[model samples]
Target: MSYAVPTTKKLIFDFIASRDTVSKGELLQVFDVTSSSLTRLLDEMTTEGILEASGFGSSTGGRKPILYRVNPIHRYIIGFEISRIGSSIFVYDLQLNQIAHVRWKMDATMTPDVLIHHAANQIESILQQHHIAPSQVIGVGIGAVGPLDQTDGVILNPLHFPADGWKDVAICEQLTAQTGIPSFLENGANTALIGEHWALRGEQIKHMLYVHAGVGLRSAMMSDGQIVRGAFDLEGSFGQMIIQTDGTRLQEGSNYGALEAYASIPALEKQVRTQVKLGRDTSLHPYAPEDIHFDIILSALADGDRLVTDLFHQTGAYLGIGLANLINVLHPERVIVGGPFMNADHSVYDTVIQVTRKNIYYAPDYQPTFSMGILKEDAVATGAAVMVRKAWDCE
Candidate 1:
């Protein structure tokens, strides 16, 4: 079933969520509803604890109107971002402020049970530290590597992490049982898009795409004021879109000739390593292989190193091809690039823009805006928190 008085509640919720307080007249104008209707809804909401009259507003001539606001301190949320390198946990108040954060690297041999236990322990510690009651924690939102079955809260087969004996584990159910709270699981990239939406006033941007490029590339689509999770939540797996045909042999999980093979950070590092072995180098000679990260490549490009610049440009072009295809299909209003590689320098942006412009099928007047993500580095965590907030509102 849909939300009761969905339009009215949305208007009220958005107003209170975005501002410190609002007046009855303002609500009436914002919702474009009759005075009687607005009064009924506001009164109902105030009685339901969704909205509270905090004080009186300044009077213009007659009696002072009452000010109302959402109760920000009455609830809390826990957000988790699970990556191959490590996992991060954050406790956010109803207003989305981070009350606590914990980050710890995972042992390479850690199983799903062990990892979940560790996470549960960290969450319990944070809740205790903040003196937050278990009931006050509305939900736990998890952003994890995919392919995920969000409906079932199961991570089917993550590419990088060792699933081993952990296939089809019920992540949300397990976490919910462990923490005594509801849990929501989503693709990491999707979470990043949610985070961007929450952080950048996303209610205005009804259609947009968020591209996450780190060790691998994935994308999340937000269209018509909602995140699109296609057939079993596998909609935004752009990494599998084929882009090249000559570089390497195709594998099962690997997108044989996909843009990720050329544009991902690991791909760039491999390119640099190959150039070094071919004795065609510049400034990367002194550092070890471990030091050849995306940042190092960007630093080399900044110094006007021709090889690294060419690599970035090449990577950007490949990324542009993939994105251009996406634009032709989705027709979003904007595309926000995230992840460590896209965050490096303007060269990447310029290259992606130039190539996308040349390849896109849209008319000149229909060009979609492209920019870096608003919550670039912390998008996953922020999205997780937003997911929790959404869950709380639904309850």
Candidate 2:
């Protein structure tokens, strides 16, 4: 269709979106445009209500320059992210304030066709619930478990999914076709990292490594305010890293142990079940072994269940080995651990941290900042919305 090349206005809006506010002088210097040209562009953008002159900034020498910022309601985006726990869709205004959200879980299955159909329908229902017309939404974005064909928006065969008929589901094309709006897709780990980045405003810190622990465990890295997307969008396959060349596991098909098989919710659940079967349990007696979910084990740990707590210690030690490799190699300024793993309570998180400290190669003083994910359960959906903003912001 040969639309005009990206305009200077996009550059200006992007700059304003990143900063809380920006001045015309700052725009001129960074954008390499003359004063008059910058003035015309900003004026046009403000008139369109995509941007606004917020107030005057402190003057360096001349009159105080007017500060510009994006209009919070200029557009809206809907984001979808599905995990083993459930599928969720959230609506966000341009400023990324969540407008509405809907979620549903399947205790037995999370097959792709069913997930797509439900998630897309819920997105429509959310828009209607908020009295937002379909036309008001600029686009949609999805953050699903990856090993995706990003170019095609097809979720490839990822681990822990349905055993059969689960390959190359064109999520983006389906959602767009269903709703008549443009769509984008990204892997869950990248979206989680990006959501964390957006929450932090991504200006102060340049390097971050985020570990996602759930049915599958993986890590995402960001450097210089950019996601480290590999050639095929599979940069953060940290889970598949062979941690043991001898031990067998049920996930990701390994005769040797993989990271997820050792350090994820499913793995922990598996371990808990096995130990109980071997007659090695105490406080988890109220629930049958088959009924012991990750959450229940977390409760058991809170009640001072020695088996559960010690089990987490073991899991944490395994994660420490992986994090040791991650920290020594990546040297990220901050490390964030998130996902259903956090639901295990602070003791588990503390154990992971304590073990990580011992395993890192660096001296004690040089340790990177480590913490739990602040965005909680909504990180992936929030990050997917951020992607929609980034994808459609230029338009």
Candidate 3:
């Protein structure tokens, strides 16, 4: 359901939401308003269950001041992540605390209609189970693979989908109609970075970059606390970065030796399959080359398979080369690298870091710290929810 909030209330809510507690005088000082007018506004919001008195604050002089906080359960937000590998739904309160969650794998059967219907059903079931009404739901936010028509909320023709009916899908309209709630869509990589940024708000890092390596390489950046979106909504364009001029191009129409040709999970799987087909002895030989998958390779690596380890080393080297180029150009304060495959293995991550440091341009007194996403698999979903809350605050 849509909520129409006055600009004054939004400013008040924004002030309170960013802090642990806010006194009425503090609000008055932050915003220019009469003492009696501010008191009335606070009273109205408190009566409306949007804000609650959370006891008193330390007194600078005279009596202690009454502090207030945004009611965490005032309204709920829904976040959905639709990716080629799987989809996840998460319910969060105004404070962005996740209260309910569900996830499901994707296959050829999970077409646009099928997946959206399932998501609507799950959302209904979650709200009912949590005793939250439809009116209490602020809106739904979706972070999905690109390229997306974000302004119109359409899923443009993204490549490598398991299903065939994904081209030009009106995902936001369908979701909003099915669930009777306003919905917003964004690129998955951007949402993931937003999610991580929210988690690290206390750190006050102004510049950051995020890379998610899965079926493809997706990336997003933030500078001076604002997300840096490109003219075109193509998050996977990072995959087209040419790391090697003479490198192999696995698919037609792809750049030779692009980042995806080496860093992505599909590329890693293809590498292993090709080596296995060439009669390279390894633990994964039990499965046919066509049947080999990313999970199978991970299992083989877990067992210390020599063939899988060598291929990972090569993949990490290429991935590091790509990261080096990005870091050198962007010079972000922090870089987060995580997705399905990145979170699954630490050895590959370590190798990528080593190679990136070896190849990255050295700038005096500049070193970008690299780490995996704190939210991990749930990063995009959580970020979607955060965006919804942010929109409400803006309104």
Candidate 4:
């Protein structure tokens, strides 16, 4: 059984959670309490299975100090990522180790009610299969494409959901009501960034940027270890930023020639289809242009289809311009790009790097490293679980 974690206990756990292992002496130095008092708290935490003595620390002219760490199995967290293309759920231990995961493709049948009930049922199944008591779970954290009322825990009118009932849905409330577990909601991009931040806690990256290219482009920023939120939760606003003043394509409800009009996965498909109509020669000519999907495009890309490669290069250049603008303003220490568009040896990623470098303000001293997201497809779901951990720390 775990003991009640008051503010002080939570603080200690937070510190220990942030590191691989921490010494009792270090805890005493950090927290303002008598050594005996702190010792009693640590003893209780260890006895309750919330913390474990990992090993001994280096001796400082005395006996080696004992190290303590949050026991990975002491508690669990559930993370959910709801997207227009797909949705996923992840179960993680206190240490953010993935215990179980499930995913499903988004379709017309996946309305709000169906999705929530399915998620709730799956949570129960996973808990039973893993021999985890429902009480062991900390809470559920949901990351979805938004325009969300995060304070009210509602999914606002996000565009392009496969189903019609996505608007103004109290998703968190519904999930919690069904499962009897607390749930929190945030933008998927923010959650992905949060997850990346947690995974790289050892790296201590304070300023970071995360961009995801999928049905649409979504972005989130982390400044000084905190996820930055705008007055309104328009995480997809970056996608609407005008990239070309007189360019042809315009995303629904977005500015003419928006970045998303050119860089999004749907846009890539559209571009490919347009080119096919214009009789651009490629291996994809065998497939009906209208039937061409992201998977088909990727298949053609893998087969070295010149038409597909050229289109990807053009798409990457447009996205790079948007990224360059962001980098100049934010000056983040690192940028992580993710989504279906990213693949091994894809020209899109390579071209994005080249164009970004070509456009960004030149400075020998300023170098912001760019790479693909480490969490990949699991980023949002994993990050949602990490957000639950963060909430626990606050509590």
Candidate 5:
């Protein structure tokens, strides 16, 4: 968000990040400006040690053009994910390689002030441990669960965090004030999408849809290589979308059944718990009613438990319907499903994919490759780092 960095320079830097290496001719052909202007910017960045010549690129009649790349160790950034259950932070080098990481379970009674101090302290501690100076840091990036004002970097009332007086918290401003490092904030789902994109940069994927299946399902889209954040950054509301008209209600007084009511992690677990309460036998015998958990359900599924598999089957079927609705409308080439739900057996993933193809709206060639994020838990945090890099575009 720094006004000091030029947009053109950022575009060039991003081009280098996207392509493994690039020559001046490629930048000239891509950018609208004259070669002289591009040369000046490249020269200035090179002089500052942000960009360096790798070697000569392929020749086409004339002398070969010199290739430029980013210096990986020139600077670093910290990306953070603040959640009610757990918060994690990581320091990444310029090339997006993680240098250090710290994670902690949230204190159940943590207040807004305590939460801020905890994050700031952890950031400082990690910096000291890695012998990194604040001056060498690009910024601190935060990806939090949102109902947030991303443009203003304000976190609105989050659903899970039970902190006292936690309304409209200015996460970016507060963290910047506390740590004196520039800060950026984004939707956790969006950050995870960005991380997926960064990891798959070599694929040259211009558009993709990302689904996070945790307590509830949330999604973000990348269209034409940019985040498809609609007005108010409130576009991705796939969870609230109706799945069944006469299906079970999530809460009383709601009209139609929503996607999250049947497909989310909590929903799946709730079904299992209900079946158990109804005197259904379970493989999860040693555990009491209160002790039933998602892990236990997964363990039972591994043991070929019929009840657990049926529960997952229902959730997967409903989720596939939701994904089909999105794909028919969005038409993204890639659809990535991730989060805690991925830990389940492949039957769930396979069922979801099968039902998705069946329900896909009429498009013969509209095949979207569905896959899981390899970064796993680190996707959001790493995307936060990329956000800061995109924000500050300069070394």
Candidate 6:
């Protein structure tokens, strides 16, 4: 009679993935499997080069069991991020160290096919640069501008890459076909949240929220250390939440009075431009519309430009209002703000704290801890690479 295959291998993989190291006996105890079964699983994994036997464990009045760990050089993954201004590609080993990176400005005139082909070429170049073999590359994880169909990896009419013909583009399928590797797609903000979780202050925090304010504003929620990909992967579309019933006119595909309309980089630039057009007395007037950017405005604020300071304060207040709502609903333990706008002066953060405290019912009595993201600009790319290891239950 044929016996059913046990899940010892999966159990061992999960146990080792969750911890830095473990002993064979601990694995048997955790999974409630017999020593023979555990040994079989470990032996098979060791033979496959998926698990490596480390040094001996501490003695317990008997023979010390050999320690086991997931192999770091067993595989590699490609991580890609498509942003409004440009794109970035990273090669990561199973240990989550970035071995190589490539970034370039996105061409406005390039069609989707051209852009994807260019991305593929860049990834290939990065792999070749690192001397990584094709067979060892597990897959590609892409964190891209959304409204994406995550199931099919199709970018559906993204606002940032409008001219790039993003409508119904099966990005993952195409990349997979070109590279002969599996592909996974996720929202950029969601990936940022994952990266933040992976790189926490000390112990990994299980529940957190990541808010990204750049050309657009978006939030991603993580519960129990896993991303909450909502129905159709739209769970964290906080940018569309209406905060003001009668505020500025909404951009196409945006909800009227959403915080993003008033707080995103484009929104900030538009407001700044309007101020300049109206001949406001400020140093920003010297900069042409093309010269105006998030970094420029933030530097202006840092240099004590009152007009820029006031604009960021207002923007931060709006962001605070959104964060208050999120805190009340999700009650996350931590909230991390990242992206271009978050790089502004402390005045912006002060405004956010003050406004959030005023608006939130819980307020100072029970505020969720807040901080800037640890990874900052690298959050999305790092998360995309970590996603591959996570998929294989290696990290």
State the lDDT at 139 in candidate 4: 93
Clashes of 3: 0
**lDDT agreement with native, every candidate:** 0.78, 0.78, 0.88, 0.87, 0.82, 0.78
TM-score of each: 0.84, 0.91, 0.94, 0.94, 0.90, 0.90
Least accurate 10 contiguous residues by lDDT in model 4: 1-10
lDDT of 5: 0.82
Best candidate (score: lDDT): 3
**Candidate 1: lDDT of 83?**
73
Worst 10 residues of 3 by lDDT: 1-10
The segments of candidate 4 whose C-alpha lies over 4 angstroms from its true place after superposition are: 1-6, 393-395
The superposed Cα distance between candidate 4 and the true structure at residue 362, in angstroms, equals 4.0
The C-alpha RMSD of each candidate to the native structure, in angstroms, is 3.5, 2.8, 2.3, 2.9, 2.7, 3.9
Write the residue-wise lDDT of candidate 5 on 61-136 in tens digits.
Answer: 9999999998777899999997655689899988788998988876556776778888899889988988888989
Candidate 5: minimum summed lDDT over ten consecutive residues — where? Answer: 247-256
Number of the candidate with higher TM-score, 2 or 6: 2
Task: Give the poorly placed runs of model 6, Cα more than 4 Å off.
Answer: 1-7, 107-111, 201-204, 288-291, 363-365, 393-395
| lDDT string, candidate 3, 1-395, tens digits | 12355588888987787777899888888898899989998998899988999999998998999999989999999999999999999999888889999999989999999999999999999999999998899989999998999989999988878988999999999999999988999999988999999888879899999998888899999999888977899678888999888898757889998899988888999999999999998988779899998888889888999999999888888888898899998889999999876766799899988898887687546778889968888899999988888788532
Per-residue CA lDDT of model 4 for 232-266, tens digit only, reads: 99678888888789775655557888888988888
Runs of candidate 1 with Cα error greater than 4 angstroms are: 1-15, 18-20, 29-49, 54-62, 105-110, 162-166, 245-250, 283-306, 393-395
Collision count of model 1: 0
lDDT of 6 by residue, 51-99 (tens): 8988999999999889998787888988889877678888887767778
